[model samples]
Target chain A: MTQEYQDGNALAGPLAELFAVDVTAATGRCVSCGDTRRVADLRVYGHALGWVARCPSCEHVMLRLVRAPDAAWIDLQGTLSLRVPLPPA
Target chain B: MGIVSPGFRRRRRDDDVQLPPGQYLTEDFPVLSAGPTPNIPLDRWEFVIASETGQEYRWTWDELQELPAEEPTVDIHCVTKWSKLGTSWRGVSLDLLMEDVETTADYALAHSYGGYTTNLPLEDLLDGKAWIVYEYEGSELAPQHGGPARLLVPHLYFWKSAKWVRGLQLQEFDELGFWESVGYHDYGDPWREQRYAGD
Candidate 1:
């Protein structure tokens, strides 16, 4: 079988619409497994509902995004913290 | 609908007879996950079979390799509408894994190394219908593909085959899994196009 899944880096486009910075370049600490990795390395699954980002270490869902017709839902309960680098002023 | 990329082209083979409804053929194996790629060392890996009643069985990575394994070529259909036919895998059958376990439960929850879990009827895992595969296409299964071990249940939608599987917990009652609770079909049958709850 082919490897059709993309990394968290693939979320840059969708994430850009929500955050001012590129979210993929951030680092996320998994709340369940306690492992930390760049958001770009997280496993990403794209579906019609939204983008689901999972922690590679424990496979716990760290983030869930649902883009509705008029609104969006973003859940980060699986993530203990997300470190996005600030842009230079 | 989103913008269609100019390079997007549907891949259809002339001899394709196994494609499921609403699915397209893909030569590529797409990696779909809800989390990060777990880096589990072989020495730390273990497979367990447990019952809600407190009985449990455990198998280390080496122990699993010593058991007899089968290489079956089967088609896999994903709930995401991608089907790959005749994919080959090698692993110990579920029959062998459950041979010594005694359980009266009618349902099971497959727990992965990561905290991911997917529920299924106990019967769906027995009768030579499933395997905990560690090898795919003649190589050690890649971590992205649920390496070390992944449950293989080709009859159901691919999501039922939990990746990076660690153990099976027999339950007296049915429990919804990560995707199941969110609207994906509980019993994913590709032939019937059961991708969502109402479908």
Candidate 2:
């Protein structure tokens, strides 16, 4: 267990398949511990369950994504708020 | 179609046996943590086994070291499709830890130092099925890898072996943990490819 796995930034590729903007760079606050951090900094665990992003402060799951053949389920209950940056005009 | 990145290829050992479906072999052990590594002093660390009715059993670091320890070599499969074969660890067996505890609970929730939790069937933890591992690969388990001590349940996916484990709370009924309540399966079986809720 010496190797460090990918961070939340690894979610950008999969998230881009759904949203127009890059979600990995977004900022969010953990609902459980109230710690704010970039989505990219959240610990990302990829498994058969899909992508799970957890708060680095409290270990509370901030997001869960499960993409099926025709649909996708995104759960963000652990996140109090998500701020997605917009492209500069 | 997905493009294969340059210099990336699945590594395999010639002696490798059958790997579970959808898994690749890896010689390197990956550290996956939901939170920052917790810094707990040995004197301040204790392993607790508590029943739902509030009967508690506690073991200090030194006390744990005095118990019988086993060094088992087993193959561990992570939920992320990485399997490391023939890994060795030294720890006290759950059987020894639960020897005196009288309980009818069928489920146990492992609580960790970083507030991480994972639930498992009581059967999955007994009968030499698991251990509270403090040494890995001839060295004290690293904090990043869930030391002062971590639960080692090799039969299930790595997630079930909660890192930085602090205690086990026996429950009468099944209750989901951090991942189980989310999208991950309640009983994560790597062999069955049970990674999601419906799988």
Candidate 3:
């Protein structure tokens, strides 16, 4: 049994339409475990059931996303805070 | 209609067999996984079914093959709205595996090797409804396709037929698995078009 998962880098493509900034470079704090890390460092797991990015420290679900033909449902109740980098004006 | 993703390659049309509601036929068995593919060596692979009473029925890779097996050709429907028809699989029926194990449980939670899970009512897993398939299309199942073995419950949405399957835990009460807890329908019946919660 392999306990491997894709890093938060994979979230880039799925979240691109929702955010103008690169979501991967942003950081999120896991509500369950209180672990803070870059979105690119979280463990991302996705399949036909849809995409789930869990906290690397506690495996608590930090993000949940299900995509349809025209819409994507994303739930982020597990995230306590998300800090994103802003570009210079 | 949804907005088409840029550069999304569309699948070819082939509607020979009748499909369930809202589903289109897919000629290829697309590889989909919740995580990295589990690398379970045949020697280390196993299957376990724990009854509500704590009795465990275990089947190792070798032992699983020693039992009587069947080749079934069935149509599979995915909650993602893709259906594959007339797919051939080789494996032992769940009816044979659950013949002796005692359980008053109403539901079961299937646990996978890569920490993924899905739940089902025991009624949906018995009779001639499910199997632990090890081969697909006459070839050894690949790792990406649930490798050494996977629970093949074609009647339900494909998610219930978990890939990288490891074991099952029978429950006396309703216990939602990973997908079910995350808003997907609890009992994913493709024919009924039960894809999301409250559907």
Candidate 4:
């Protein structure tokens, strides 16, 4: 069997059921403003099933994720989900 | 343009608009498209997923309804510093799209028009964790945004979630796409801040 995240869930399952607050065990700090937000709030926005969120205070938008404990070096081993945009061509 | 740093006081009007600490102008960013502008059209579009065995699943206008759909508000971070939030998208779920397809391999490669491709594990496509979005912000997704279809992997760094999605092919070995091949991290993880060819 493939090693699974804590939920043993894959990436394409029901959005909410597969990725609840438990998935985001780690914390994500806003890259822009530097405020640390809960992984769950950052992950879901708009509504319960929302995928994005805007910081109520700083207004800096962030790509949310369940914190990856071993984020120090992301290769194929880690689950990389950064939403940073591509630089201008 | 720069982004405001954390704790920076906000002004009511354009006062806050001055370059923030990390923000940059969109014009300075890379152009995302299918290919040369002329051959790509908003009306003509296609998305497919092929198993390592060569079995293929294709989506067309009429067949699109056969799959499941969803609306998600997401924050898209480019390797560049512009973070756009509250973006909405609708499309067939990757899990629903690959329901009938069989894959013997452990990995898959997402391919697009401009020689863009990204490798992902097979589990990501089968478990309903992602989507191939055809619509954005309540509108038909535009060409610049990988209209008709773009892979949305809310889990992995957005780059592995290929845009301008044309087909998905199961692969036994990992292959790098445009950004990955160049210098972006193979898998982009935001929390860790992995944003270059090599982290």
For model 1 the local lDDT of residue A71 reads 50
lDDT tens readout by residue for model 2, B1-199: 3597787887666355798888888888877765557899999999999998999999999999999999989999998789999999999999999999989999999999978899999999999899999999999999888888999999999999998899999999999987777667899998899877788
Q: Highest DockQ among the candidates is held by which one? A: 3
Candidate 1: tens digits of C-alpha lDDT, residues B115-153: 778899999999989999999999999998999799999
**lDDT value, residue B130 of candidate 4:** 83
Worst lDDT run of 10 residues, candidate 2 chain B, spans B7-16
Write candidate 2's Cα lDDT for A23-72 as tens digits.
88889999999999999998886633467788888778788877655556
RMSD of 1: 9.0
Runs in model 4 lying further than 4 Å from the true structure: A1-89, B1-35, B38-44
What's the TM-score of each model vs. the native?
0.73, 0.79, 0.80, 0.55
Instruction: Provide per-model DockQ scores.
Output: 0.15, 0.16, 0.35, 0.02
Question: Per-residue CA lDDT of candidate 4, range B27-112, in tens?
Answer: 22244332232235544656777877778887775577556688877655554455454467898787777777876788888888
> Each candidate's lDDT (Cα)?
0.84, 0.87, 0.87, 0.56
Each prediction's fraction of true contacts recovered: 0.15, 0.09, 0.58, 0.00
lDDT: worst 10-residue window of model 4 chain A: A2-11
- Considering TM-score, where higher is better, how would the candidates rank from best to worst? 3, 2, 1, 4
> On a 0 to 1 TM-score scale, where does candidate 4 land against the true structure?
0.55
Q: Model 1: per-residue lDDT, tens digit, A1-89?
A: 44445689878887888898888888999999999989899877773335788787767778877554445557787899999889687
Sort every candidate by DockQ, greatest first.
3, 2, 1, 4
